[model samples]
Target chain A: MRARFNSLPPRLKRGLTVFFVLCFAITLADLVVHKHGDHWWNFFGFHSLYGFVACVILVLVAAWMRKPLMRDEDHYD
Target chain B: MINAPFLILFAGAAISWFFPAALRKPVLLIFPVVGLLNLIALDPSQSWTVSLFDVELTLFALDRLSFIFGVLFHIAAIIGLVFAWHVEDRPQHLASLLYPGSALGVVFAGDFLTMFVFWECLALSSVFFITARGTERASRAAIRYLVIQVVSGVLLLTGALFLFHDSGSVAIRALSLDEPAGLFFLLAFGIKAAFPMLHNWLTDAYPEATASGTVFLSAFTTKVAVYALARSFAGLDMLIYIGAVMACFPIFYAVIENDLRRVLGYSMINQIGFMVCGIGIGSELAINGAVAHAFNDVIFKGLLMMSMGAVLFRTGEMRGSELGGLARSMPRTTGLCIVGAASISAFPLFSGFVSKSMVMSALLIEHHEWVWLAMLFASAGVFHHAGIKIPYFAFFAHDSGKRPREAPAHMLIAMSIAAALCIGIGCYPWLLYDNLPFAVDYRPFDIPHVVEQTQLLFFSAMAFIWLQLNGLYPPELKSTNLDSEWLYRRAWPSLYGRLCRIAGWGQARFYEAVGSLTNALAPPLRKQAFLLLMPWSVREMLMILMILLAAILFLLFLHRPL
Candidate 1:
């Protein structure tokens, strides 16, 4: 499976990038469309930005938490 | 009345004990189906109630809410039974039946007394799954799990007693927080719901259960708590913030945790938070959303647990640090796991998207802007840990060169059913929504909702990939991340040890002071103390003689005076 994935053409290798581009484009299109509910939905790409920011914060905070929270598997023992 | 679903399951559990090995699996599978059939056949117009010692108990209340939960538990039982078909353990099988039976009992209960009875049964039956692993860690974890569950049960009973005392009725109904009894009930439900600090038992125990045991453990206990909360405490405003904290905090732990199953345990709490928030809103749409989400969670989370169980069964490993690239060997499990992951991540056209959107939309409808934002953040965080982290490290990261066979046929069939349900519900949500307790007018697949959800999930995936490629993502390591359990597991024990040491020191000093006082008084009192310590017989004889002479002299003097 790894070989197959690696053997793919450059265009295919960029599949992840293409997916991200498409997501961003959808977000852009959603900006012009008026949503039925919450005024927050009217903001351009609110959910996309929220997702990215939340994930980044999660990773950074987890890394910080490791200093105090992480211990040997047998720490309790 | 003769064939209450819970009774059938209990009877099945009892009879299965006498069944031979060949008949056990069939018995296990047939019991749930028969019970489900019995449940379906029951007349909703009349409840099965009994009077015990003049106290009324409702055994089967087939209302819409209970009906939905009842069907979900029965279906979960069937899936769990299939997943464990390869096992020959009798106790585990019994527990699988009894656990679901007790959960159904809680669901169908019409009064607090009946709920309490089933609540305790659920705790007792479910603990077996954790202990069935038969490891020292599993035993310890099971004990902790049982303690927490029993505590919750006690809280429920105590609250019920108070409620009965105050109202002279035991009917399970919505409670106002002005009464102290309501507080106790809230706490009891909160503990099982994995409310923040009370949550450690779940993360501590579920991961340690037997491979299939964890699957069953994942489905019933917390969802039953959700049912209790929704039934009795809906619209309690405090649950909104509590649910927000629950949804957000676990992701940090999930990010760094090495145990894949433990991460799932944390994610379970996060998902439950959404349901809880909806219950707090207490609107028709919100309550329906909460119920639907609970239904969806059981299926999808069970699928996730089954996939992890299959991995554990094949490799005897639970840590992400110890597993990678198993897709080469267990491609089917891999594919199914990703499906579970997508459903949980709320990717468009998955079970999660259909249900979770309801809670988010409900929060907005209730004008809970801040709470809605927190849930939105949680959605992304869930995607980070459960969606990206779980599948990424377990199946696709650097190859660890472990070649395990695919999961057994029964396991695959079970997982396929769950995965199909997830997609089926996502694509055609009306099938689930039509059965909700309230009329649900919410449509999940509106263009804006889909676009927003898809953007959020896809962008989260992008972040994961970006971090992974940059070597910035925290590598899964063989370590334990401290959680609320630290207070009881580490801090409380250490504190007790310190207090013991201090008491020992004080006791020693106390003895030493007493001894010193005795020593200081010894010289002055020694001589007199020796006489005092002398045998009393001789001293009494001499004293008697002296007394007799004095008496005689006194008598003589008195006679002369006369």
Candidate 2:
């Protein structure tokens, strides 16, 4: 199990395939499934796009913040 | 007989402190169970009251809201004690009992005086958990935590006095924001709830406590604040914005935080934000959502903390940079942590979904469209940081070439119990809904809600994996990221140090000039008449506040004016 865990990158292709497949599947499900929308719920995959974009922006903004905020481990000491 | 449910815990604390070591764990375990049973058997119509010098104090009152919170504290205490089963440390053990005992006290308190005593106890007892670590950082953090907590308590006291003066009663009731000293109540509860600027102590201190100690730290303090806010200031429009900021700001900090436990701490604030927002919404369904979320958060958050605690227990490392591939060694802990992550992330069938969706829906019901959007962004951001970063870096990121044993049986048992509650609550929310303070009309498992929540979570994962593959995600490193506490810890101290140096220089010049004048005229006056001016002390400010409070107390109680 440890050896298998170590070889993480080689399985990226399969992982990506499954990921895209699931993403496409979820988008389709939204069209077929009966659902309620709060705002802009008409667009298929609106939530997917929102979640992805929101996450990306969150990480980028935080990474930018680290420049001034990050300090040495013992900075306070 | 003697305030059965909560005081039993206080008794257990005393027993554990004075009794033999071998009996401690069994005693601790039995107390929460017995407490829960006692709570269940208690008649809600019964009220414990005492007349104290013309003031009526309801020592213990059972209502639907307090009932659920009492149940939660017991469950949290049990899980927390089991997690700390290996801890032979007396202070930590005693504090574990006393801390939750106080939380239950706060929950059941029907008057200000009863609430204040236990409110302060919540702070006083919990500090032992941090001090139990016996490190310089923990010691400093403990004192800072205690000071902030004490200030919050004092604010509560001040608010209660003014409340009693204004209404001629000290009962816990819905206070109008315009009421005299109502702002004090908000500030007091806000500080405990970690409202925006007042939040850093939680993120600062929890990560520094010992492993099991962090679990207890996570459980009680903030949730008690949430309960207090819900009880007192529900429906305040201003809280909507405050809750939104509380929900949104912490995720960014969580994103960059190296300490995994501190990341959880930030997200803890984020979770409480939802509860606060629901309280602001003040609708029946919204209050139910807030209360249920508080219930679920204790279990799921404790589960996450327990997993991290187990890792810290075994490997002695908590930073994401210093941890990796722990799943290979402690597979069960990894699996349980992911359960916690998923629950917090609000996937379709997790505890957070049932409760968080209700708050979001309440936002729309109240026409808080922009706050709703901010909350949605927070959902995504929390998933990015706590949901993904915690498990990925701590368990499955590039193996750091370190392996450690699985957590002890007791710890795993504790984690499993909490994890089970997370899934159980998600799967059978009616088990939670039936006990809520209001009738929960919200349906979390509807096709639209489930589909939408799944889309949000999956795409968040899609972004995380993409960022990781392309090296766009920020790498965890051994560094401290500054937050609000930096004002007191870094900026204020250094600023004060420079000010002290300048003051010292001024004082020296003053003395030298005075010496020269004295030598020329009166030699005897140089040392004795040097200065009547004294440097400022924080104690003096506290003294003034105390004197004011004493005067108010005299006016309120004595009814005699000088």
Candidate 3:
């Protein structure tokens, strides 16, 4: 199974990439066509931007938290 | 009519002890199915009342809420049993049955007394699974877990006594905050619900449990607390902020924690926070959403835990740092785990999407703008940790050159059933919605909702990929993250050690001062004091009494008549 995945043809790999891009394109298109329930959500790619910003904040905060919160595995012992 | 689901499970636990090894597996599998059937046949309005010592205890009460929880627990029990079927240990099997039985007891309890009894039973029975691991860390973690659970139980009983005193009844119904006992009840439920600062026991202990034991542990305890909070404290305004904090803080810990199971434990808190917020909103839609989410959480969260269990079983490793690239060897487990991760992250067309959106929508309708924003951030954060990090590090990251075989057939079967439920409930929510305590008017699959959710999840994935490409994502390390448990586990012990040293120093100074004073006075006073130390003879006692009498007479004469 690993060999099959590792040896996948370039065309198949490109097809998989296209599939993901198409999915994102559909949601992006919905930003223009669909009437959103909330005005805040109506901005083009609002959720996509919101998701990206939220994740970046999470990573930064976790990095800060590590200074105080991280300890040896047997810190309690 | 004579049987309750709790009784069926408890009896099955007892009978399984006497069964031979070959017969034990079937006995374990059959009990939960029988219990599920018994609950299905139960009448919702019926009550089984037992009067003892002038306190009427409702041992069994089936209502819409209890009915939903009862069915969920039974299903969880069956799935947990299937996952643990390969084990030959009798005690672990007994604990698996009894643990859910106690939770079923909590759900069906109609009064505070009955609830307290089952609540304690839940604590006692569940501890065995942790201790069954037979490692020092597991044993210590179990003890801490037991202490927290027992404290919750004690608080519940104390609150019940006060509630009964004030109200002249122990009925398990919605309570007013004005009641003096209300705070105790809330704290009790808060501890079990893993409410913020009160949540460390879950992360501390769950990762230490045996692999299969963690699967069962994931299902019952915290969800029972969610059920209790919904039953009694729904619409309490304080829960709104409390639940928001609960939802938000854990993602950071999950992000940096090395243990994969502990990460899932943190994610469990994040999921329950949504349900708590839903209950706090208290609208029909919100309550329905909370109950529905609770049901979905058990299946998906249990699925996540089971996958991790399978990983640990194969690799004997729980740390993400030590595990990677197992997808080639355990592809089926990987697929199932991704299903769990997707469901937990609330991806479109998954169980989480169907249920969690109800809470978010209700928050918006109630004009809780800040809370709605926090939950949205949490949704994105959950996608980062539980959704991406779990599968990424465990399965697809840098190969650690360990190629263990796939999980056993039973574990896969259990995971498949749970995975199927996660999708089934996502695609067709009405099967769950129809059983909610309140009517659900909200729709989950509207075009805007689907589009927005997909955009959020996909973009979150993009961020993870971006961080990885930049070499900026934190690597999993072999370490612990300090949480609230630091107070008891580290701070308190260190403080006690310092206190003992100070106390010992004070005592030494006190003795030294007394010893020096005695030594200085000893030469002059020793001879005189030696006479007093001699045993009193009868003649000496008489002479001393006569002298005392004469002194009294002289004093009487000296003050005569004045």
Report fnat for all candidates as fractions from 0 to 1: 0.76, 0.85, 0.74
Better of 2 and 3 by TM-score: 2
Candidate 1 lDDT over B194-288, as tens digits, reads 99999999999999999999999999999999999999989989888888999999888999999999999999999999998899898998899
Clash count of each predicted structure: 0, 0, 0
DockQ of 1: 0.52
Ranked by TM-score, top first: 2, 1, 3
Question: Using DockQ as the measure, which candidate wins?
Answer: 2
| Candidate 2 TM-score restricted to chain A | 0.75
**Model 1 Cα displacement at B526 (Å)?**
14
- Where is model 2 chain B poorest over a 10-residue stretch in terms of lDDT? B553-562
> TM-score, each model?
0.91, 0.91, 0.90
The residue pairs that clash in candidate 2, if any, are none
Interface RMSD, in order shown: 3.4, 3.7, 4.2
Model 3: residue B503 alpha-carbon error in angstroms: 2.6
Docking class of 3: acceptable
